[model samples]
Target: MKFKLLAAAVSSIALASPVFADLVLPWMSYRTGPYAVAGIPLADGYADYLTMLNERDGGIGGVPVRLLECETGYNTEKGVECYESTKAEGSLVYHPLSTGITYQLIPKVTADGIALHSMGYGRTSAANGKIFSNIFNYPANYWTAASAGVNYLLNENSGSLEGKHIALLYHNSAYGKEPIRTLEGLSEKHGFELTLIPVDHPGQEQKSQWLQIRRERPDYVIMWGFGVMNQVAIQEAANIRFPMENFIGNWWAGAEHDVIPAGDVANGYKSLVMNDTGSEFSIYDDIQKYVVASGKAAGAGDNLGTVMYNRSLYMAFLTHMAILKAQELAGTSDISQAEMIKGMEALEITDAMMAEYGLANIGPAFSVSCENHGGPGLGAVSQWDASAGKWNLVSDYLVADMDLINPLIQADSLAFAQENNITERCN
Candidate 1:
């Protein structure tokens, strides 16, 4: 009996050693990029969360999680290089915040049995889990955001959009195109005319698009912009005397960087907030005590709750939770990319979990599965209040009507399939 027990112990040790080699996290972030000002806070917030987990909670599932950082400059080729360089390290999962990179790498990651978490951005059609099995999006996709935008306008304008023109001024990239497919549907449904205005990337110098906005005189303008483009759009809108309130931005368009440049002129501009805002949350306080105080904080200290920072932190939190969930199902401290992928597919976010994280009213705690990867469609509308120095949620967790958006998602998924020569596994 003693000899048999010794042999079993040796076998168990061998199995455990290999698992440890696969669990480290490889982060592809931009500490230096054209959009680094936006990317830095998010990266710092994300890094801070991992630090908090390691220092405060004893490092997820009793195993220490280490973050490996590689700056991608929000460049697609650089992002691919990062992926190839790190894949051998057995990265449990990846969150490439840039939509261009995410679109480029989806198939490769799926084939490698690794997961990609793009919560608020990326190809909107990927929200259908049936097609993009390894991709995870916690909140609704761009389609849902576009649908919500349409619904908000319909309600505010007394339910009639007949003969009204809606203008889309978007960065000319995969990220900007995400919501156009959805908005087109909404236009047809509500009898609104749609205009597409493409702005080349780096999103600056749009004298021409603004000129068109003035000439066309659309009833509503939806800005699909980021970084310097956001501010420029606002300033242009102000210069053209376009109704600021009549213009709305996808979540990326509204931030301290965007509005602060425009200052008081940006008051009442609306944005689709990705998560809860403000520093009053418990997580921020924890970050202050641990990350900021420890002298490990990255980026400008004042950039903490700026829009990009919050989005990055939110992305990091979801990735962390997915890892823990994967370990739970595996029933072991050692994990594999495949195990982490399963964890991501099976995880759900409860109200209690949100409150514990200091996000009490963040809304629609996510629930993931094989068929539905976009866990939930939950977000709120926030309007800029210049004097208070922040965008505040004006509406409660507006329960986005998924019942209407799901079919639209399927149709878009089908269209993408035809274009890419990809087929849904379900059919």
Candidate 2:
């Protein structure tokens, strides 16, 4: 189960990095941007975990891990600049929280022969490892999420969605537009009517969109949103008295901040998620003791156990595990960038593995492979309980319509390969 993010330097054991040099993982994060309110917690979570690893576990696999933090400000150009500056530090892999940045970095990462794990965002078709090669979007991606939403609706309607009116209220960006094609495909297959409503950048004004929603009254409104957009959308929906139970948001819109602003009106608003959003996991205790209590926590340390924080924490945990897998494959503590990539390509995540890492049932289990860079594409639907000020999973980990997704991936990735002259691997 090798995942994404491997850099190819030190081609052999003898050429491996000098003993005790830090294993660098670059963070192209946005602590200041239109999305900063949402980005802060994520930045804190990612940094604190590695800081915890250094503090609690003395670094991963006995090799000190160094996080080269760069402020991308959610700007695509800045993200690339951060990459250009940081790539020289022997960093093997990169995790960018911006889909726009991820799109820009795909070609750059491939040329550099480095690993790029875009997490759940970025280009959905990168799930095709044979075509993507150096890019990975394992565990989940936007298309799977879109299908999952439709499937959840199907379940709610007793296994039928024929003629149901489903509206997608999405931010108008590459990130927001990602789910449209998949939703369209799902709509065609399930006989549901689909509507697309786009909200512009920063999403400060969605009055017209909501007004249209009010006029049309779709059965379900699935949102693809982020940052201030999320909070504002919830409030707008509430103002219209739209049934909170009928509006489902993607994982990016499921945070406390997203609903707290809307107050109790946001109760029963649903969202899809890949990671456990609860604070009960023992790993939080470890994070508290090692990262927070030790006076080394990032940001205000208030985001602990929050939704966005936990998301970043999960990502850092996956990154940590990938590094260990790489180390074992490279057979050395000081693995080269190439070895790190190989390690990611071979990393497998399961329930037992999460438990071993002190975060049992933390996320969905998936094994990576050459053909499928994306994992099983599984996720669960969670509803916000405004009374409890928390999110609870209302469904088991649900599978995406990959039977529909695979052909889409192949057509897209193979087209990408053809356009870019990439040779498909793992045939």
lDDT of each: 0.80, 0.89
For model 2, give the 10-residue run with minimal summed lDDT.
Answer: 1-10
Residue 315 alpha-carbon offset, candidate 2, angstroms: 0.5
Off by over 4 Å in 1: 1-22, 399-404, 412-427
Per-residue lDDT over 197-288 for candidate 2, one digit per residue giving the tens place of the 0 to 100 score: 99998898999999999999999999999988899999999999999999999999898989999899999999999888878888888888
Q: How does model 2 score by TM-score?
A: 0.95
lDDT tens digits by residue: candidate 1, 1-427: 9999999999999878744543577677887868876777777777777787776776787788788787899999999899988887888888787888888888889788888888788876677887787887777677777777777777778988889999999989778887887788788878999999999977679899999999999999998898888899999999999998898998888778888888788888888765777766678888787777887676446677777777777777777777788889998878888889888888887889778876565556778888788867766678888899888887665556576678877887778768768667744
For candidate 2, the lDDT comes to: 0.89
Q: Supply the TM-score for candidate 1.
A: 0.90
What is the Cα-based lDDT of residue 283 in candidate 2? Answer: 83
